[model samples]
Every structure is written in C-alpha cells, then in structure tokens.
Target: MTVLPEWPAGTVAVLSTGAGAPHAIPVSTAIRRGDTQLAFALALRRESLVRLREDPRCAVVLLAAGLAITVHGRAVVERELERIAVVRVDVESIQDHQSPRFEIDAGVAWHWTSEEAQSGDAETRAAVSQP
Candidate 1:
C-alpha cells in the first residue's frame, strides 16, 4: 500500500473524456485525521465531476517547495450541495517527483469518512503560486 503524505493546496489535474482533453482544475483541499482522507470544494458546473462519474480514473499532482507527488487513482464523488462537491479517491499509486523517494504501489484503497472532512474551501491564490 502506498502511504501518501498530506496533499497541500494545489491544482488537481483531472483526466476526463467528455471534454476530449484532460482538464486541470485548481482546487482547495484539506486533510483531516492524520492523512486518513482529503476534502476539496468545487463549483457545480465543472466538467471533471461529470467525467469522474463516467470514468473514475484520475490523477492529482501537488507541489510545495521542491517536493512533488503525482498520484493516479479512482475517484468517487460523494456529496453535492450548491457549488460544492466532495470527492473520495481510491488511490492506486503515487510517484514522488522531487528526489526519487518511495513509491506507492497498487491495490490501495484511499478512504474518507465524513467525520474527517474539513469544513472550508481552499484558498485559490495561495495554492496556485510556487514559492
């Protein structure tokens, strides 16, 4: 099982077939309960959600400082309220791009419970810039 460290706020690159091109959407994410799960907010009209419904396969890349983690997984969308939607991902594998660190192998289920969900949205401007 690949144990991924907490995903800092960043743009999530969601692969979808509906648009005929992969869409990279900037989203805010929070990890609750010791990396047990991740929570993010999204607008109601985003195409990625629909794509996820059609196909669960996706990827998320997070970079902070010089460290980067690229993850490939199957995502299941949970709740939808107004413009906010929560997504749960079953992580299949992750690649650390910074220095060739440990890699998360296959067959790993990334679970997220309601209690561990964070309550707010991620800051867009803060997440998009690299420092």
Candidate 2:
C-alpha cells in the first residue's frame, strides 16, 4: 500500500499510463478525495481513457515552480458528468522531490512509467535552480 500526499497548489497535474509505449496527458481538474483516492475530470473517450481502461495502473505527477510530486496508482472510471468523466485513482506509491525547496519554486512533472514503481528513493532529485 502506498501512502499518498496532498498535492500542492499552483501546479500542473499530468496523468500518465504504461499500457503500451508511455503516454501522458495534462489534467486540469484533479482533486484529492481523501487520503487514498485521487479524482480527476476529463473528456470522455479520450486516448487517456482508452489506455486507462486497458490498464488501470497510472501515475499522477504534480508540478509547480521547480518541484515535482509523483504518485503511482490504479484508476477507475467513477462516473460521468455531462460530457466529461470522473476518474478515481487508488494511490500506491509516493515520491516527493525537494532540494533546497521553497513554495515559490516548487514544480511538478508527469511521465509514464517505463517500469513498475518501487519505494521512494533520494536519487531522483536535482538542485532547484532559481530563475
């Protein structure tokens, strides 16, 4: 079981999948439902939907400033709201990147997993450069 973290504000959320070659889509309306569930709104019948339907496993990356938070999990179609569908993800892993970090320079990025998730490691972070 992966413990999830709260996504910070002013960041971009990206949904990624590994159904075939890696794929990712920018998510705009994602919100955390609880400690274990993450929900995001998207258009119905999108490529992201097809990939997720084929493989529920995915990663949601939140980026803001220069910091990134990645959450790996399994997602399901919760329901539909008009022309959009709501997807709920069960978080399974968490990796937070912070090195000399501050609220102003926090950045998030999303990517499809080329391999299965592993426990969080410290080697993935780089020095946060100020612009």
Which structure among the candidates has the greatest TM-score?
A: 2
Model 1: clashing residue pairs?
none
Residues 9-95, candidate 1: write the lDDT tens digits.
Answer: 433433322335676764444332133334444556878777777877777665554446666777666666655566766667877
Residue 92 of model 2: what lDDT? 83
Q: What would the per-residue lDDT of candidate 2 be over residues 3-89, giving only the tens digit for each residue?
A: 555655324688999889999998755666677777776677688988888999999987766546788999988766555666888
Q: Please report the candidate that would top lDDT against the real structure.
A: 2
Root-mean-square deviation per candidate = 10.7, 13.4
Q: lDDT of each model, Cα atoms only?
A: 0.52, 0.67
Error of 1 at 65 (Å): 2.7
The candidate 1 region of ten consecutive residues with least summed lDDT is 122-131
The clash count of every prediction, one per candidate, is 0, 11
Error of 1 at 111 (Å): 29
Q: Model 1: how far is 82 from its true place, Å? A: 2.4
